[model samples]
Target: MNNGTPHNTTGTMSANVSYYNENFVANSKFAIVKYSDRFFLQACMAFEGVSQYIDFWIPANIPGDGSIIELSLAANGGNLASYSRFPDGVALRARSGRLLMKYDWQTKRMEGNFSFEIQNGSTIVQISDGTFDLTGIVDGVSNSSIYGVGTFTAYSDQLGSFEAQEVSIELKDRSHVGLPNYWQIIGRMEKPEFPHPQRSHIALQVVEHVETKIHTLGNNPDAWASYFQEPDVGIIPAVNGTLEFTTLPNTGHTEGRLDADFRTAENVLIHVSGIFDIKQAKR
Candidate 1:
């Protein structure tokens, strides 16, 4: 993404915060070429960050080997550097209209609507509420701009469709302040394939296997505790029996959908893919 748009990067703090909020319009295009029976996809993402906007273009032409992509920041080799939450650098093997998005540190009350496409020529449009936390390690201990994850739920009528869109990282009211506002995940879906009627009986099993405690000291050192345990005895495990799940019949892969929601210690709510695996137990 290239933009004649200008950026503003002016800050003074102990930890350097790379600013990417400069307003600029980046135009990107994609072209898929078919040379043989296989199809190769090429995509480019351009956006303004810090001093200047950079371009990330990737081309994948090898059959069965998968595609490759990269992100380039600061075209003129400026002093500023941009960072992505995604540890894998640029998203690889992404289909058209597929994106891995996250909010910047400076953004607050992040809310937006976006669309995601699936392999079956279908799309999922989602609107979500952003999540946040006040644990800014780089901005010193007194910064108000919190960074964390958020929960999301959207409705769609399309069957057998699963996709994630409209993501953000933002702060919320004080009601969510310091309440162990940890992660909670729940999922429900339909079952598409059932070879054996009785054999196909399935249910989701949720485990609260982990927990972390945070104690903030006033302009002092931080303390915490961590542990792993099973689901609470009184509470029934969060599970949706007979939800639609993906299947691979050729290699003996079968199961139902497994939806998950998790809140990190940093107040980030991550929606992990809940794919179930069901089969006979070993003798």
Candidate 2:
């Protein structure tokens, strides 16, 4: 389904896609396309669990550098942020600021940097010094190999917010025979508090597949989580205080939201919240 660029297509002459491009499937395509009097940007990228996206009203033309363009959750009855996980985004507005769009019409490229603010009821995302480029974006649909995606984010009262250096969430049932747990969400970060310069890895689990709910470690073995690291420091059988999926679970997709606060018998806290949509392992 790699249909190539939009160079030969009608009204799609000027288009490009800039993304991680890790998977060859449809999920790998993150694009921006503009034609006639509207701009459309759609992305499935992630900053760990907190994804930044736009799927709604964008001004029809370039406002030039050092100018501001208002963003609306509803314009012409269309949700600009169609992919946002926030519950209420109509009130989500940006900070009064200008985005410097250094666009090049001849090259069909656009680049800019701006930091804005938006909120969905109580959930707020302060887009800190965000930058974007659509010099090589896409203007076509994808194949049928991809589906839903999830989100993850976490905060600590003890320490500031942090993101995982790596994330690997999967279905334990696919890897383990007779394993009761249905899902395994794992993340890792650097830990200087430990003995050596090793990374701290945490993995959480849930017994049911319908949703990811908070579960205490000792309550039952059906739904639980654990933590460990390299060099065998110590292991912590853990519990989750908050866990949620962005949407209801369905077949062929495993994307949802997650927030977990787990600890060891030594009271070491391992907190993580993010979104994921890793495909179910092949049967």
Candidate 3:
């Protein structure tokens, strides 16, 4: 079945493919194959119950040649993330070509030379004109040597293809609640019973105080209550203020100093101030 020869079809493309590539057969050695909008091959190979081997194959609709493969779980309905363990085993022997896979958050692209070992033999990888064709025995048999369209390396060592799971949360009527804001009255300067040269007493004035909290309201009412009840739930608060303080001298004259602290509900603190306001009050 080598050499552009359309081999016999065990199953049509529209039908579920029981084989791995053109040669890699789906044996009971690993796991079973499942199909949806995409095909998933899952298998777990155990060794001494300590070490494990696994393989997950996902077919790409990308036209083979030198085209970017866009993979996404139909369930999740987004671009597929780049996978590591699911290494690009398909080797294109030809030069002057680039193998591009979608970029995951960690890496920019998935590119590699595809190599295969068949029946206890050395790893053989063929590259012709920038096209990699992986044709090797999977389990001591060439019958299962199908060119892997793609694979996914799960975060766990276990191998398997996961369709993107669609998940969504909504807020019923909390559009008005919004984020949380906070303010704390800090230390205040005062004249001790023992008078000093600083003059009269210093009175604390709470010009303004604000508190805010941010959070995502769950779709269900119960879920929202549970979420808000948690010690830490919501977005960062956005609130500010202008604090003005005045000090009076027993001589019927007034002077003062001003200090302001800007803070978020998350307890993040900052000092923002200008100057104190000194004005005489008309009796």
Find the candidate with the highest lDDT and give its number: 2
Residue runs of model 3 more than 4 Å from their true location after superposition: 1-36, 42-45, 51-60, 66-283
lDDT of 1 by residue, 230-254 (tens): 1101011111112233432112233
RMSD of every prediction: 20.7, 17.6, 29.1
Candidate 2, residue 62: the lDDT equals: 62
What TM-score goes with each of the models?
Answer: 0.15, 0.33, 0.17
The 0-to-1 C-alpha lDDT of every candidate, in the order given, reads 0.21, 0.40, 0.21
Q: What is the lDDT of residue 217 in candidate 3?
A: 22
Residue 170, candidate 2: how far off, in angstroms?
Answer: 2.7
Candidate 2 error regions (>4 Å): 1-153, 157-161, 174-181, 190-196, 208-218, 229-234, 248-252, 255-260, 268-283
Clash count in backbone of candidate 3: 34
Worst 10 residues of 2 by lDDT: 9-18
**Of the candidates shown, which would achieve the greatest TM-score relative to the real structure?**
2
Q: Which portions of model 1 miss their true places by more than 4 Å?
A: 1-180, 193-283
